[model samples]
Target chain A: MVDKKQALLLEDFDIEIVSRDLNFYYGDNQALFGISVGMPAKQVTALIGPSGCGKSTFLRTLNRMNDIIPGARVEGQVLISGKDIYQHGTDVVKLRRKVGMVFQKSNPFPKSIFENVAYGPRIHGTRDRQQLAAIVEKSLVRAGLWEEVKDRLNDNALGLSGGQQQRLCIARALAVDPQILLMDEPASALDPKSTARVEDLIGELRELYTIVIVTHNMQQAARVSDFTAFFYEGALVEFNATKLIFTNPKEKQTEDYITGRFG
Target chain B: MSGSFSENLIYGLLRAITYAIVLLVGYILFDIVIKGLPVLNWEFVSGYPHQSGASGGILPAIAGTFYLVLGTISVALPLGVGSAIYLSEYAFQGKFTTIIRMAIITLAGVPSIVYGLFGLGLFVLFFRFGASILSGSLTLACMVLPTIIVASEEALRAVPKGYREASLALGATKWETIRTNVLPYSLSGMITGSILGVGRAAGETAPILLTVAAFFLPKLPNSIFDQVMALPYHLYILATQHPDAEKVRPMQYGTALVLLLLVLGLSLGAIFIRAHYRKKYKW
Candidate 1:
C-alpha cells in the first residue's frame, strides 16, 4: 500500500464512516493491501478503478458481504458510528441492516413489486399491512420508481424492465432505512437513458443517505459524486473533491486515468 | 457443397435413430394395449382373484401397490429431501462431501435382488417386522432413497445463488433465507423427484417379494403388519406359478397393463409438476 499522511486530516469533515488500515485476502491471495479512507456523511463518494482493482471488494467490506465467501479473510478495522464492525461479537445482521447494498446486476426477488420493497421491513418484523404499504411507497418514491409502478404493485418484479428492476433493487435497499447505501456499479448494465435516470436518482439520494458507489465510467463519477477516490492495484491512489480530481488531479496516475491515457 | 452434404447425411441418420426409438416404444405400447384391453373392464379391476388368480380381477393387488407406494414415499421423501438440502446448502465441498456422493452413487447401482436379500435379513428376520407391508415399504424406501437423493440434489442446485445472496445481504439468517427463499422455490423440484422415485418403488418386485408380497391373497391388507398382494407378484404367479398358467393369460396381461399404467402415470405427474414450476419461476 502507498503511504499517505493525509489520513490525519480525515477528521476535518463530518465523517460518516472510516476504514483504518484495512487488508483483505481470498484464501491466502491478498486482494487488498492496507487501505484507509473516510467518507463524509450524506454525500456521494465514487470509487473509480479498472476491473478487479479492489474497488468492488472495498465496497463489499462495508456491509461484511465478504463473510459469505468461503476461505475469505479480513484484517484491520471498519468503523461506523465509532464502532469497529469487525470487533468480536458484532451483530452482522444488524450491521447489514444499517449498511444496505445494491449489486452490479439487478437482483429483485421472485416476488411481487410490493413484496420486493417490503421484504426488508417484513424480515425485520414489520407485520401490519398499512405500515408495509407505506414503507414500500416511500422507498419507491425515493428511488424515483413509484409513479411508473404504483398501478401494478402486485405484479411480479421480474416483469419490470431492466432499469426498473435496478431501481426496484435500490428501493428494496432503501426500505430498510439504512443510513449508508453502497452501490456497486448500479448503472453499469443499463442503457444510456436508464443510466442517466439512475445517476440522477443517486444525486437525489445523496441528500438523505451517505452513498458510496463504484463506477467504471469516469464521467459518472464526476457527474454524481461529491468526492472521488481513485484506486489502482488494490491501493487508493488519490481522493479529493470531484471537481479538483477532474480538473487538477494531484497525482500523475490520476491525471492519466482521467485523460484515458491508461487504466 | 460436400460439407453441407455430410451435414445432411448426419442429420438424416440422427432422425432415423430417433424414429427407430419412437417406433420401438410405440410397438410395445400398442401390443400391451391390445392384449390387455379385453380384460380391462371395471369388474376385472375391482373383483378379487379366483381359482388361484386364473379366473378373477386383481383389486387386492391394486390396493396393495397403492399402499406400498404411499408408504415408500412417506418414508423416503423426508430423508431424501433433507439429505439433499444438507449436501447442497450446508456441507463443505471437500473429501467428506465427495465420500458421501460416492456412497450414494454406489447405492444407486446395487442390484434390486441384493436389496431384497438385505431387507429380508434386516427388516424381516432381525427386526422381526415379519413379511408385512411395513417391512416391504421400508425395503422399497431404501431401494429408492438413492434415486430421490440424486434428483433432489439436482433440483436444489438448479436454484440460483443470487436469491441466497440477496436474502442474506438483507440481514436474514441462513436458515431464514433457506426456509423462505430457497425451500419455496425448490419445493416443486423436490416433490417431482419424490414422485419419480415413487414410480420406481411402485414397480419394484424383488424387495416386496421377499419382504411382503403374498402368493394369492384375495383381500386388502387390514394393517401395516399384514401380508399384501402386489400387482407384479400377482402377475408373476399368474404367468408362471398357477396350476394352469395358460388358462389365466388374460389376467396376466391385465395385471401387466395396470402396473405399466400406474408407473407411467406417476412419471407423467412428475413431468407436469416440473414444467409448471419452471414456468412459475423462470430464474
Candidate 2:
C-alpha cells in the first residue's frame, strides 16, 4: 500500500460533490465500503458496475435518498458544493435542490407533460407562470423532448411512449436547475435511438451541470462522459478520464470489466 | 375409471353449488325490486308518516339519512386519510407499528352492532351527547372509520414510489411529495374507497339502532344535535316493529330499493371517477 497522496486530487478544481471514505449499509448487510470519488464541476462522471455492485446505493448516498429506506445507514462525508450533505445542519431538502436525479425508469408523475416539467420549479418557489412556462419549454428542449410533446403539453405524461417519458423525466430533473444531476441508467430503459438522444443530451448538459451517471453499458460511458469510475462489489476499482480508463486502464479488474468479463 | 368420473362429477356439483350461492344474492335483489316498484312513487317518497303510522311519506327520514351520512363522511374522511398518510408514508414499519396496524384491521372486522354498542357507550353515554344526529353521525363515523383508513392506506401505498422519487429528486420534501403528487394521483382510488365507505355506513342498520334509534311517531331534525329519523332506522322499525306493518310492507320494500339505488349511484360515481382518471392516465 503506497501512500500515494497524488492518487486523489483536491487542490484546484471546483468540487461539486466530494465523497471521502463513504460507506453504506442496509441493516446488517453492507452495500458499499469506504469509497472516495471527486465529482468536479460541470462534468459527467459515470459509475459503471455489474448487477448488485452498489452503484445505485452510492448514487443514492449523495442526496440521502437512502434515508427514506428503513434501517438503511451510511457513514462518510458527501459534500455538495463544500457542505457535507449528511451533517446535522444540512437540510436534505435544500441539498436536494442543489442536486437533482433521474432514475432508470421513466416515471413521469402521471400528470400533464407541462405540469411534470413545471413541478420542480414550482417547488422551488418559482411562481411566475410565464417564467415557469419558459423553464418548462427550455428544459424540454434541452432533454430533446420538446419537439415531440410540445403540442400536447396538457396530455398526461403516462400517455407518452417509453422514450418520450424518459426524456420528460430528464426535462423534469432539469426543471429544478440543480448544479449537479445524478442519472442512474437514464437511457437503459430507452430504445437505441432514445439512448443516443439521451447521450447527446448528457453531452450538452455537461457544459452547465455536474453529472454522475450509473450505467451497465460501457460504450455509453466511453461515448458521452469525461470521466468514468468502475466499481466491483462495493469498492471503487478505478476512476479516470473516459479514454484512459477504456483504452489504457490500470487495474486488472478494470481491464476485465472493459474486456467484457464477468462484472 | 369409474371412480375418477364420479370425482369429476362431484367436483362439478360443488362448483355449481358455490356459483349458485353467489348468484343467490341477485335473486334477493330481484325479489326486492319486484315487490318495491309499485310503491316507489313520487308521492310515497315525498309524503310524511300518516295517521295510525301508515300510508304517509318518509321524506323527513330520507332527508335525515342524507344529512347523517354526509356529516359522518365529513367527519371521518379527513381524519381517516390523515391517519393513513401518517401511517403509510411517515411511520417507520416495525413490530410495534405492525401491532398497531393489526389492531386497526381487527377493529375494522368487529361487528357493526358492537360498534353501535360501543357508540352508545362512548358518543351517547360517555360524551352525554344523547341520541341526536351528532351522536349518530359520530357513531356512524366510527363504524366507517376503518373502511376509510384501510382504503386510504391502500390507495396511498398504491401510488408508485417513483412519483415520490421524482418529486423528492427535484428537491420537494416528503410531505410536499405526498401533497402534490401522491395525494392527487391516488385521489381517484381514495374516492372509490370513500364511496364504498359511505355505502357501508349508509346501509349499516345494526349500530345506528343502539346509537340513534327513532320510534318515528314523526318530525324533522333541525340540527346535528337534534334527534332525526334516519331511513335505515326508520326502515328497520317499519319492517320489524310496526304493529300494523303488513298493511305498509310494500313501502318498506320501496325504501329498501331506494337505499339500494343510492348505494349503487355512489358506487357508480366512484367507478366513473376512477375510470375517467384511469383512461386519462392510460397510454
Candidate 3:
C-alpha cells in the first residue's frame, strides 16, 4: 500500500471525486471503514476486491445509490467536482445525473433500442423529436453501439445479444450526459469476447468521463484502469497506479490477492 | 431402476389426478350446454321477460348484469390499483403496512352473504342510494377490491428491481421511474387481476340480491338509481321462487349458461391482453 503521504499527493492531479473519512453502514452492520481516496479527472479508477468486501458499497455511496435501501446510512463527505454531495439539501437526482451508473446486469427497459437510449434525455426534459433522436444517436455512437443497432432502432432492447445489451445499457447511461460514470461489474455477466468489447468501450470512455468501476477480475482492472484501489474487509488496503498495484504492490495483502493467493 | 420406477409411478398418479379434474369440469359444462342450448334463442336473449319469467326472454336481466359489471369496474379498478401502487411502491414497509396487508387478506376471505349484509347496511340503507344499480355496483366493488389489490400488488412486485435502479440512476424521480419503467411492464398483470375481480363481481348474486336485484321487472334501468334484474338472482328465482318452478327450469339453465359465457368472455379478454403485452415485453 502507498503510505498516507503518497496517497495524499494524488490530490495534486485534477481530481474529479474524493471521499474523506467515509464510513457506511447497513443498519447496525458497518460495511466500510474510514476510506479516503482521490480519483483523478478523466481517468479510470478500478475498485478490485473479492465478493462482500464493500467495494460495491463504496462505489454506491459516491452517487447515493445506497440511500434506497432501508436503514442504509453514510457518514463523512463525498465531494464531486469540489462540492460535498452528501451535504443536506443536496439534489440527489441532480447528483445522480452528473454521476451515472451501469449495473452488473444489463437492465434495459422493456422499450425499443431507440427508447432505451432516449429515456434519460426524455426524463430530463429533452422534448422535440429531432433533438431526442440526435442525442440517442450520439450516445449510442459513443457507447460503440450505433453501428450495430442503428437500423433496428425500434426493435425491443431485450432481443439483443448479451454483449449488445450491456453496450445498450452503457448507451442508456451516457444519454444523460453525465461527467462521471460508475460501473458495477459491467462485464462480469458477458462472455470473453463481449468482455473485451466492453473493456475497449471503457478505455474510450475514460478520455471524456471520470470512471470508477468495481470488479472481481484483477486482469480486468490492470487492463482497463489507470489507477486501482484494492479493498479488503471493508477497508482500503491499497490505492496506487494500476501498473504498481499489479506488478509491484506495496502492501502484502494486495500482492497476495493479485498473485492468485487467498482473496 | 428403483428410482426410475418410483418417478414413473408418481408421474402417473399426478397425470391421473389432472385428467380427473378436467373430466369433472367437462361434464358440468356439457350438462349446462345440452340443457340450455334449446332455450337460448335470439328472442330469449334479446326480448324482455313476460308472464312472470315463464314465457318471454330475459333481456332486462342481461342488460342489468352488464351495467353492474361496468359500474363495478369503474369503481374498483382505480381504487384497487391505486391502493396497490401505494402499498408496493410508496408506503414504508413496517408494522403498519403488515397490519394493512393482513386486513386485506382477511377481507378477501369474508363470505359473499356477509358482504351482502354489509352492503345492505352501508350502501343501500345508510348511504340512501336505495336498492338500485348504484348500491349493487358499489357493494360488488367492495367485495372484489381485496382481490384486485392483492393481484395488482403481486404484479407490481413481479417487475424486476433492476429496472427501478437503472431508471433512478439515470436521474429519474421515483414516480417517474414507476410511471415509465414499472407501470408499463406490470400493466398487463394488473389488468389480468382486475378482470378476474370484475368477472367475480359480474357473477355474484348474494351482494346484489339485497342491494339491487329486482324480482320480475321487465323494463331496463333508466339510471344507476333504478333497480335492475340481474342474471344470477333471476336464475335463483326461476329455479326456486316462482310458482311454476318446474316450468321455468329451462329459463334457469339458459340464464346460468349466459352468465357462464359472460364470465368466460371476460377471462378470455384478460388472457388476450396478457398475451399481447407478454409479446411486446418478454422480460
For each candidate in the order shown, give its overall lDDT on alpha carbons. Answer: 0.90, 0.85, 0.94
Weakest 10 consecutive residues of candidate 2 chain A by summed lDDT = A1-10
lDDT of 3 by residue, B1-283 (tens): 9999999999999999999999999999999999999999999999999998998899999999999999999999999999999999999899999999999999999999899999999999999999999999999999999999999999999999999999999999999999999988899999999999899888888999999999999999999999999999999899989999998899889999999999999999999999999998879
Which predicted model would earn the best DockQ? Answer: 3
Task: Sort candidate 1 into its docking category.
Answer: medium
Candidate 2 vs candidate 3, lDDT winner: 3
Q: Write model 3 residue lDDT over A178-234, tens digit each, in one string.
A: 999999999999999999999999999998999999999988999999899999999
Ranking by lDDT: 3, 1, 2
Candidate 2 lDDT over residue span B220-255, tens digit each? 777777777777877887788889789878878888
Per-model TM-score, in order, reads: 0.94, 0.94, 0.95
DockQ of each: 0.62, 0.70, 0.81
Candidate 1 Cα misplacement greater than 4 A, ranges: A1-12, B1-13
Q: Look at candidate 3 and tell me the lDDT of residue B135.
A: 94
Q: After best superposition, candidate 2 residue A206: deviation in angstroms?
A: 0.9
Score candidate 3 by DockQ.
Answer: 0.81
lDDT of model 2 at position B95: 89
Candidate scoring better on lDDT of 1 and 2: 1
List the candidate 2 regions with Cα displacement exceeding 4 Å.
A1-12, B1-11, B280-283
Which lDDT tens digits does candidate 1 get at residues A66-172?
98888889999999988999999999899999999998889898888999899989999999999999999999999999999999999999999999999999999
